[model samples]
Target: MYVAVKGGEKAIDAAHAWLAEERRGDTSVAELSIAQIREQLALAVNRVMAEGSLYDPDLAALAIKQARGDLIEAIFLIRAYRTTLPRFGATLPVETAEMACDRRISATFKDAPGGQVLGPTFDYTHRLLDFKLAAEGEAPVAPTREASQEATPHITTFLKQEGVIQTEVDQGDTPRDLTREPLELPADRALRLQSLTRGDEGFVLGMAYSTQRGYARNHAFVGELRIGTCAVEMEIPELGFAIEVGELELTECETVNQFTGSKTEPPQFTRGYGLVFGQSERKSISMALVDRALRWEELGEDNMGAPARDAEFVLYHADNIQATGFLEHIKLPHYVDFQSELELVRKLRAEAEENLASAAANTVPEAAE
Candidate 1:
């Protein structure tokens, strides 16, 4: 029979009280509201929603507050809460062509149909800190222009028409949901993208960076990267038609990689794709690179033993919740294991000394004889 340690409830309660105090340091300062967090820390809220697989900004803000600004903890909270809600039906595939794009850029083309709209970006800004913002100085209004209403054609489509890029043949198959099912090896492109979308932003970024450093170099160029809102629609069984459920912000990245033609095919530019919830451009870009790296078999490219090329490794280590749980569990009581190890070491040392002493005694006797 084994007896476990107790007082978890009492310790947890006290810890919670201490945490609340720490969260609101300096009583004279005003307490932050969920609304303020939603509005002021919009980027943080967006990240939580993106990684959590939940799009509710309000709930994400609340989770952030409850977690005391730990983004991973907030994401875990959102994911846990999301699992409890009853799933009715899935929406149809979102149409990016009809997206109300706010920010769109293409590196492959000098100019695209809608042109490069660098909306709300930190690009070209100096990294020097402005001390004027310390006093909450008023900022100048940003210049704006009316956006074009024309449907933005994908940059890859242009290459496809020119016969310079490989056309992806759509194999009509329902994509597996990672949220509902256990991740299996040799995942399809859809499953790999899903994992990458919900994967840790830093981890994915590192993996992508490693590829550039020659782990599995795929000469990649950003074909197109767009950030905007797309309408979601779901088919109603009774109504016999699809209706607009809601609109969500999305960041989509498409990478054009140079693929040397195999025996069966001609040389062409292949593609790697990423679509993530909210304006997570960095994550989306990294996802595309990692996605292409993992598709070695499909692309007829050498694996080159890259970490990012391993689907099993990337998917398994992607989840922050799983990583945190396994990592943090090491802090738990290991007295029994430690004691067993201690005893074994002591026994080994004692046996070694006894053997040495016996050998010395036998040597002395032999010499005297």
Candidate 2:
């Protein structure tokens, strides 16, 4: 018999140390600071922030560097770090009508009151790789446009005024966070949005794309996509009022979709909503489509068993951190379970051999008789 390995602890520690050394990479050349990754690798930071459900890009960048740019690892770091953050209290509901947007666009309207500002997007750029950017360099400048001080009216609100958009009454105070509490079936808008905000961007995008490909097709039109900073304030119990904690960058998308006329309803346009931690328009837009699709049952429509229509499926499978952890853990040892299965198979084979011998002996007696 072979001796079982006993160096697991030492091996694990050595592997982790080697990983840390690899992440720092050529330390003599100077370590790439977190600030550099936050500013220069903005796109990667955005991806981490989107999935981590946290607003700080600097923290996300640091997590990425620490994780050796293994994105799933970085996401896990953000999620774990965010869980420990002390929640002083809930902030006042952000007024999207006054987002102070860096980017705002509505496909439902030809010319919105604020005028569509496509700020800091790669939408129109060709997909050519620039060799000049191989070495780190400064980004080119774009002329800044003057922002309006007056509050910009929402496109959905305009539709609501004219009875075009379906009006859902406010449900008093907002719902609880799903992370802190166990997820109950039939989650409210707040919980649903929270789950989607931290969901895998690719998975969410595929689900949204599936809607277009005839699975619970909602005929969605992007009502608006806005990204900007908003003030976060928490109420102090002793002070009896909310104070500004800080500011956070957010991306909000609203979708207009078709609705059905039921026994108690009239045919009207419905809504799908998505909101995320950063200026992630693509993720927010995808999230909005998927959100609306999931509401098919609540809206009194047919449950077509679409991926997006399954709330449990979407909510459970959307987190990359959980997915990757479970996935990679399979690489770890499972010798005890394997040995049990091996023993069971050996016992079964021995029983089968005994039975065969008994049967053969009985046959020989019958032949002799």
Candidate 3:
């Protein structure tokens, strides 16, 4: 058993007390409610849910509160909690085609079948601070237009019809889950997408940016970006039929990238797909960019020694919890290793001084002679 040092228990208790006090800065000030975080800070909650791989908004809000608004910490908490829960069964893949879209947009065509619907985005908003929101008074609800009922078709369908883009093929194989199995090199598309979905958003964004800055540049264009609720279905073997299990909000991005045909194939466009939980468009888009870059092998493109193209490098470092744990562990006791290093440095210095003294002694005797 690992033994605690002297006063370790007392120090831990004191540290916890200090942390609690710090969490609540002033008694006079109203405590930030979980409901406020769930509703007002919905974006943060959505991100936590996305990265944590758990879709419970209330629990995510609670985790956020417990973490004192540290999003990565909240995600870690949720992920830890999620591991304890018993799994019932796996649900069938949700269909994006039947999505009840709140926001749908395409960049390839200005006037596509389903016109670009900018639902609730900060895209066109000015970055000016709204100081009025600082007051506690509630603001009036803004009226919203009725959402279109027409089923929105994917923008890539147009290219597929003309044989300009590669048609999506189903290999009919269960994707290897990174959470359950060790990550293998040269990961398949499904495994790669899974990693990117749960990857650290900032790291994925950086990798994507590198690709755009001429590191295995793929000339990617946002073919379509859709945010909506999709129904999850599960096939019950006993019943011999599928039933709707639940609905979940998803943000899906499809990037159409430039592709030159191989010897056996004709010139066509390839695609990179990203689907993340909730309204995480930035993460989804970044996932798509990285996804495309990692496809250099299948696409017959040269490995330009790009960071994004290195599947092993990207997947290994994209996990925040793992990164944080390893990074923060440096604070723990390293006395033995540190002492060894210190001794080595001292020995090197002593050896240098002794050599210098011997050299001086020899030179003085020669000069005297």
Highest TM-score scorer: 3
User: Please, what are the lDDT tens digits per residue for candidate 2 over residues 219-279?
Assistant: 8999999887777777788999888888777889999997766665679998889988777
Runs in model 2 with CA error above 4 Å? 1-3, 135-137, 146-148, 237-241, 345-369
lDDT of all predictions, in order shown?
0.89, 0.83, 0.88
lDDT score, candidate 2: 0.83
- Candidate 1: residue 126 Cα off by (Å): 0.4
Model 3 global lDDT (CA atoms, 0 to 1): 0.88
TM-score, structure 1 vs. true: 0.93
* Best candidate according to lDDT: 1
- Candidate 1 vs candidate 3: the TM-score winner is 3
When 2 and 3 are scored with lDDT, the better candidate is: 3
Which 10 consecutive positions of candidate 2 have the poorest summed lDDT? 144-153
